[model samples]
Target chain A: MATLNLSAVTKSFGATTVLHGIDLNVADGEMIVIVGASGCGKSTLLRIVAGLETPTTGHVAIGGREVTRLEPADRDIAMVFQNYALYPHMTVAQNMAYGLKIRGTPKEEIARRVDETAGLLGIGPLLGRKPRELSGGQRQRVAMGRAIIREPKLFLFDEPLSNLDAKLRVQMRGEIRRLQQRLGVTSLYVTHDQVEAMTLGDRLVVMHRGRAAQVASPMEVWARPADTYVAGFIGSPAMNLLAGTLAEDGAAVQLRAGPLLRFTDGPRAGGEGRPLTIGIRPEHMLRDGDAIVTVALDLVEPLGSETVLHGTLASGEVLTARLPGMVPAVGSNMPLAIPAEALHVFDAETGRRLDA
Target chain B: MQDAVLARQAMARQRRGRWLAHAALALGVLIFAFPIWITLVGSTHDAATIGRGDVPLLPGGHGLENFSTALGEGGGRMHTTPAAGMLLNSAIMALLIAGGKIAISLLSAYAVVFFRFPLRMAAFWTIFITLMLPVEVRIIPTYQVIVNLDLFNSFTGLTLPLIASATATLLFRQFFLTIPDEYVEAAQLDGAGPLRFFRDILLPLSVTNIAAMGVILFIYGWNQYLWPLLIINDRSMETIVVGLAKMIGSGDTQNEWNTIMATAVLAMTPPVLVVVLLQRWFIKGLTETEK
Candidate 1:
């Protein structure tokens, strides 16, 4: 087990800087997931930690030892690539035994470890089969087995479940989490899938552009996003953001969509008449008779037990709401009540959260 | 009724196409096999009969005698080497050239594709440009170098000058480019050094390509006539193709035509055996590159 520390890690390609000064400390046996949309440099950050790519300026310390300039093998880490990257000519057993063999492990010890690891992965019957002969999930397991056999201090996963089908992705996701926890190895996972990040990470780093916008627990990121980007990115159906202005001496917001909702938690720091962007989740839109704003329904998606409503405001701002039970028809005006306690307040210009 | 008629018409067209294909293939086989068939029949006849131009259409009882004489002893009235010695020389030269070409080309191709040293592309283009210069274009300069090195009348002289194959190197480089970058990264993460990765991963993956190139290079080496004839004046060092050419005298009547045919037949055997033994791997290697 190990703790990973990155201090002011930055990466650049020519003038195009990919990662801008990311600092994170992962506790022993903690799994820190770096999640972002493509080109946001999540993969580059994981590669930096794995020693696959060096940071432009930073230090990477694993288990209190500096390994910023070391080779990938010398860093005592293992990586599972997106495509599994098993040697095509080697059998599953040989693929798992390769790292140990390179380190001059004894023949019998190598064979014993290979068998044990294969059994743990439930791939004992597939020991003699080559990579092409295995299914996608089987290949993914073999890739993990290859990494696990090394028993390194760190595990780096770069979208390892991407190649598997949906059901298998979920199954392997749980399996990886269980294996990481059981092994208690400090791990860093990189994925663009928000669900994988939420389910897998002990803590999440939501990256935007080239910077880590927020680093917190998944639920904290969901409940209190640090900026408009994290607020919108972390949840399904995406949190709704509306243009507004601070009014009534920091106690209320006057939405551009014609709703003046007061903050129930506390007064925000912004003074009256200051521009702001009000945030609300799709599921938080209430269908009460006391309507604050009305939306003209454009499309109604009934998803069995619940329905997702897509509509437009009088100001031509698009809005989405997830409501329980089925809505009967489309192309009608629907009134939604905004709960004061559920609203998130951010500065209109900077998109930073305005604390009470 | 219309669908049935259309189906019958398609069947008739397919049958006609099959007939044309078979006729074309039969003509090609006959065109290639006629001379070899004549040589086989002539080897079974007396030398006087063949020399008189009354070439036999079928084998006679003298086949074993002619083959034994051609193999064990030199053809009468010709200063050519024995068929057995020429066949041995050809075998050694062919094996050496094929092995040397493959080893050197694999290393060169690996270097060009994997390593990122300065002027790597320049080095690759230099090798590529030599494909335009065949043996006849650079023969004199190559011969001068061989003479300077005092490698005349040796297998080294025969094979070494011809071993650096640009075509084989290009083929290997193309195949190496198709290998995904993940394999290299994975090997590095597995703690294998560069040479270890080459031996453990790259070489095994290149088995089929090597087999296909081996067939082509071996045939090219076996059929070498111009270079061997130019360099080797010693009869004992002569290859089969060169020795076979020397077996024919300017005066046709003085030549032992039956023994010459037998030596020709013996000269064709090793390359045929090589193709037959490696035909499956050669075809697979050329057709499919995927793992």
Candidate 2:
């Protein structure tokens, strides 16, 4: 149980810089998930914390001890890899006991801990089996058991549940969240999946191109993304971003798709005719007779509880709407209103949020 | 009715092809086994019968006598050592060479694959390039080095020069590369240093490769004739292959063909036993490198 701090951590491979100075502070016993697309340096930041990779220039401290230059073993950290990375030649018990055995724990004590950890993981019957004999889910449990038996101050997970099927990923996600809370170990988890980030972390660090775009609670990030990149990344069906310009003295935005949507919160501090990007989430698009914009449907996906309509506006911009229950069939025009409170305005050129 | 006729034709054609394949394989087996059969038959015969150019195709009644004489006195030749002593020497040399080569190759391969140091690739290429210079190619320089070291007529001289095998090292290097990098990271987190990793993880994983390489290197050591002939002048240090060659003595005197044949059979037995014992593991190691 330790607080982790990474200050201005940067990494580069030869000429290409991967992580461009990321700084984050994780509270003790809190799980902070770093989520991003591939090649976005989330894994690199986690590895830097793990002492598996050295940052080009930065410092990492765990429990008030500087571990930037320490080896992973000396850093008092355990990592669960995506592939489980269980030593195939070892039985499950041996895998779980390996760290303690290497630390010269007594044989009896090692046995006792292996039994205890196996019981905790519900893998007692599997302790005698080799990794190859276990299913994918079983191997995942053993990997977690191996990390847990060490009782390290910090835990690092590199997309640990990404290898499982969808149903198992969900199940293991819940289990990992419960286990991390119960163990109360400070953890840094990296994943490309937004759902995992949303459900697993106490706070989420939505990364874009190596920098932390937003670091906040998941719901906070969802409701108020920091920029256009994060606004598009964290939600399913993605928030619809339309190109527009500030009009009526920055109190409203004039859409190229022939609608004037006013900012409800307050007037953004931008000059008139300033280019802007307006964001509206799919679930927030409401059906109204006198709507702001009209969409001619091209694709309609109907679930039992909701319908996702993919269409294009008359002014030639694609929009998706997730409405409750089924809507009309494809090729019909659906006039949807964008609620004023749901508007997310950003600078068109810089992609930064335009806050009032 | 037409479909049944076509099926019958197909079955008959398959049977014919099988027969043809079996015939070809039988011919190959005969071609390979003929010399060995002749040696077996010749060992059972009297020397006088073979000397008269009337070597029999079938076995003779003097098989036990010939074997005992070959084992006890080694054909009464002047330079030839007894079969038992030569067998012991050959066994020791083969076991040492195989074990030493495996040990050295495994360590070198582990170093090249796992560690990052200055000139690592240079070291690997240096080891790899030695494969081009086999013992037969650089035998004279090797002999001079052994002689200068004063290792003449010693088992150390006979086996040590043959111990560092480039092929085995390369094979192990390729095998080690197939191991995932995650295992190394996982082991690092487990607090295992290089030596512990090698002992706990690498050595156990390489059991099949060791068995396979053991079979190959044992045969290579057992069949060595030129190196042993160059270094060993003492009768006690003579290996079986060299002893067998010396038993004939340049075709000058009436040789004890029966004894020589019996010794040849005895010389082949140990290598064959090693291969037979480890055949299953050898095949598995060669074909399947996956975890």
Candidate 3:
């Protein structure tokens, strides 16, 4: 197993920069997932680490050996592509043995490794079948087997489960996490799916527009995002954001949202009279007449376990609330409570966390 | 009574249509087969008898006699037989040319399709330009080059000038373009070098195109006339087509129609057999037209 490190890595396709300078250190045998939206260069960063792409600047070191200029095969890293990229002409066993064969491994040893990996992947019965005969999930297992037989220092996965159906994707995600844990291999995974990143990552690197927005554990990123972008992007149904200002009211600080509601809590220091964006998660908002703000329900989506209510606060800003049970019918006016502790405050102009 | 009459009339018309279609098809088949039948029938008669146009359409019971005479088995003073030597020469030349053309075209196509190099587009256009310039147009200069290389009257001389046809290169290039780039990338990741990739991946996947091109190149080499006639003067080195010309040029005293026809049939056998055997691949290769 190896610890991978990217030091000040940058990439560009001509004048258009895809990855700004990125620095990250992944601990040995740790699973680090890089998540971002499309055009965010998360996949490019993964490719750079896998040695399939060359960074325009900086260095890539794996297991303390610099491999920025090395070929993928020479770097001794195995990548499971999003498309699987299995050799369609070869049977499953041959596909798994290809890397070993190319390295001039003995026939018996190659067969033994391939057999063991196939067994581990639960694909032993599919040894003689070609990739075309295998289903998407089966092909994914063979691809992983191909990489595992090499027993490389590190494993790189570029959205490996994205091609499967929703249910299969979930199943494969569990399988991959289980395999990675069992093998105890250092792995770098890239995905745009927040749920996958949250569940699979030991450390999550949230990227936006080619730069790391926040690098933290999943729960830490959820609870304390670095910026308004992280707060909105990291959560399902997204975090509710409203423009307001913090005002000093004697011993407590009140977040005044126009003339309709005022949220008071800790004492204000320099935040008074400054424009700020107040953030709240859907699950954090509750319906209580005792709270400061009142809202008119615009829509309700009952998802069996939880109902998401879409409505506008009295300040004319939209907000969503996830209630424990089915919410009232659409267009029902209700008073909503904003618990002071669940509130996230960000600088309205800069979008940076105000408390950071 | 009126309905029955109409049904009977329709049945009659349908029968007539089928009869007319069969009649036309028979006429077309006869048009194609008549000359070959005439040639076979004429081969059983003496030259004078064939020239008189009075030879019976059926075999005259002189088939073996005519063949023996044509094959130089008659021991006649005027008899000339070079059929065996001509067939051997044609086979050797065709085999060399077909093999060389396939090797050259496959390598060039693979390189053009898979690699990045300076002057790649220039090389592709150069090969494409040759398609417009027929072999007959370049025969003089090509012949001079062969003569300068001391390859005159050699089998290598006969086959080397025809090795760089643009059709085979273009065909193979188009075929190779259909192969997914992922396959090459996968092989590269697996640590395969260029030669290994070509042999294990590219070549195996191109069997249909190779078979199709091989049949075409074999036929072109087999039926070559003008160039071989100009370059090869030795009787022992003459190909079947050139040897046929030589036989036909001789006076009637030495010319035997039956032997000539037998030799002609033998000379045409290999190409016809190849086309028959690889017809499926030939059609498939042409029909795909993949870019």
Candidate 4:
């Protein structure tokens, strides 16, 4: 296991910059998931760390050794590609043993390791089959097995489950997490799917426009995102953002969305008469009469375990409330409540969290 | 009843179309086969019998005499005419040229497709430009270069100049381009260097292209005439094409139609065998390329 550190890493293709200065320090044996939207350079960052792509500026160190100029083979790292880039000509066993064979490992030892890794992956019976003979999930497992057999210092997964179907993606995600835990190898995973980042990361790095927005544990990022982008990108169904102005009333500061629903979060010294965006997660909103404003329902989506109610406030601002059960139907009026502490205040112009 | 009649009319039209297609194909095959048939029949007739212009509609029983005369039965008369050495010389030169061309094309194509260096694009275009320039245009200059290298009238002169054909390089480059980049990336991650990557991954994947190019190169080298004739002036160094020329050059009164036809038949053997043997890969190469 090794810790990967990137210091002031920047990448540019011709004149267009893909990655701005990125600084991240992954702890030894830590599984850090880098989450971002497409073109956010998450995959490029992983490739840079894997030594597949060289940074236009800055350095990459694995286990305290600078490897910015090293080729991928010299980096002592293994990566599982999204397409499961297994050699089409090789059997499952040969695919797993390929790295060792290239390294000049003994044939018997290669076979033994292949058998052992295949057994661990529960693909022991498929040793002689080529990659085309295996299903999508099986090919994914083989790709993982190939990496595990190498026992490299770091494991890089570039959206490994993105090609699989939803059910298979979930299953393979669990399998990967379990395997990583069992081996305790340092890992870096890049994905656009926030759920994979949330569930798989020991620490999550939320990237925006090629810069790291926040780097913390999954819960920390969920509860306290660094900015409006991180807050909106991290959670499912997304957080609801309403544009308003922060107004001072006595000793408390209140957010006025449209003079109907007001959110007061203690007293603020500087945020007065300034444009602000108030953020609240859908799960945090409740269907209670204790709220400051009553809302009229516009749509309801029942998702078995939890129901999502989409409605408009008296101010005509759209809001969503994820409730525990089926709530009011469309066109019905209901009162909505949000805890005062759950409100996330952000600068309207900058999109930076005001309370952060 | 009206619908049935219309259906029947359509069926009859389809049958007529099929008959016309068969007829066209038969006429095309006959046009192609007529020359070979004439050559075979001509080989069995005595010179006087052929000159009489009443060539038989069946075998004339002069096949053995023509075969023996072409195989050197005429002693000093036909035996020392370079026809016999032409077969062995052409076989050696064609095999060497085919082997060298395949080797060079594969190496050049792999380097062009997989590696990056300065002037790579220039080199690719330079080689590709030669495809548009026929060998006939460069025969004199190529002959001078070969002679300057002291390869004149030698096997090296005959084979080396024809070793670097653009057709093979183009075919191989297109084939290599179809292989996904993932394989190269995967091999790189597995500790394979460029040489090993080319050998283990790219070469194995390009078997069909190599075989197809090898067949084409063999035929092109085997059928070469003007350059080999211009370069190799020695009687012993003459290829089958040059040898066929000498047969037509001997005094018209002494012309041996039977032996000339026998030599023609022998000359066609190598290219025909090459195509027949590698037809499977040739067909696969053509079909796979369309995808």
Runs off by more than 4 Å, candidate 1: A289-291, B1-11, B76-79, B251-253
| lDDT tens digits by residue: candidate 2, B143-238 | 999999999999888888788669999999999999998999999999999999999999989999999999999999999999999999998888
lDDT by residue (tens digit), candidate 2, A1-356: 89999899999999999999998999999999999999999998988998889999989999989999999999999999999989888899999999999999999999998998888889999999999999999999999999999999999999999999999999999989999999999999999999999999899999999899999999999998999999999999999999999999989989988888888888988789999999999999998633378899999999879999999998788999999987999988878988878889899999999888
C-alpha RMSD by candidate, in order:
1.8, 1.4, 4.2, 2.9
Docking class of 2: medium
Interface RMSD of each: 1.0, 1.0, 3.5, 3.1
Q: Estimate each model's TM-score.
A: 0.96, 0.98, 0.87, 0.92
Each model's lDDT: 0.91, 0.91, 0.83, 0.83
Show pairs that collide, candidate 4: none
What tens digits encode model 3's per-residue C-alpha lDDT throughout B71-104? Answer: 5532123345456677788888888888899999
Model 4, A1-356: lDDT tens per residue? 99899999999999889899999998899999999999999999998998888999999999999999999999999999988888877789888888899899999999889988988999999999989899999999999999999999999999999999999999999999999999999999999999999999999999999899999999999998878999899887899887766565422234454332345545443545677777889999876634455668888999988998888876667888788977757888887776666877777788887652
Order the candidates by TM-score, highest first: 2, 1, 4, 3
* Candidate 2 deviant stretches above 4 angstroms: B76-79
Interface RMSD (Å) of candidate 1: 1.0
Model 3: residues >4 Å from true position, as ranges?
Answer: A249-273, A289-300, A310-318, A328-338, B1-49, B54-81, B250-255, B283-291
Q: What tens digits encode model 1's per-residue C-alpha lDDT throughout A241-327?
A: 999999889988999999788888878885688999999999999888343788899899999888999999987888989999988
Superposed model 4: Cα runs more than 4 Å off: A249-265, A292-300, A309-318, A327-336, B44-48, B55-65, B68-84, B289-291
In the order shown, the chain A TM-scores of the predictions are 0.98, 0.98, 0.95, 0.95
lDDT of 2 at A70: 94
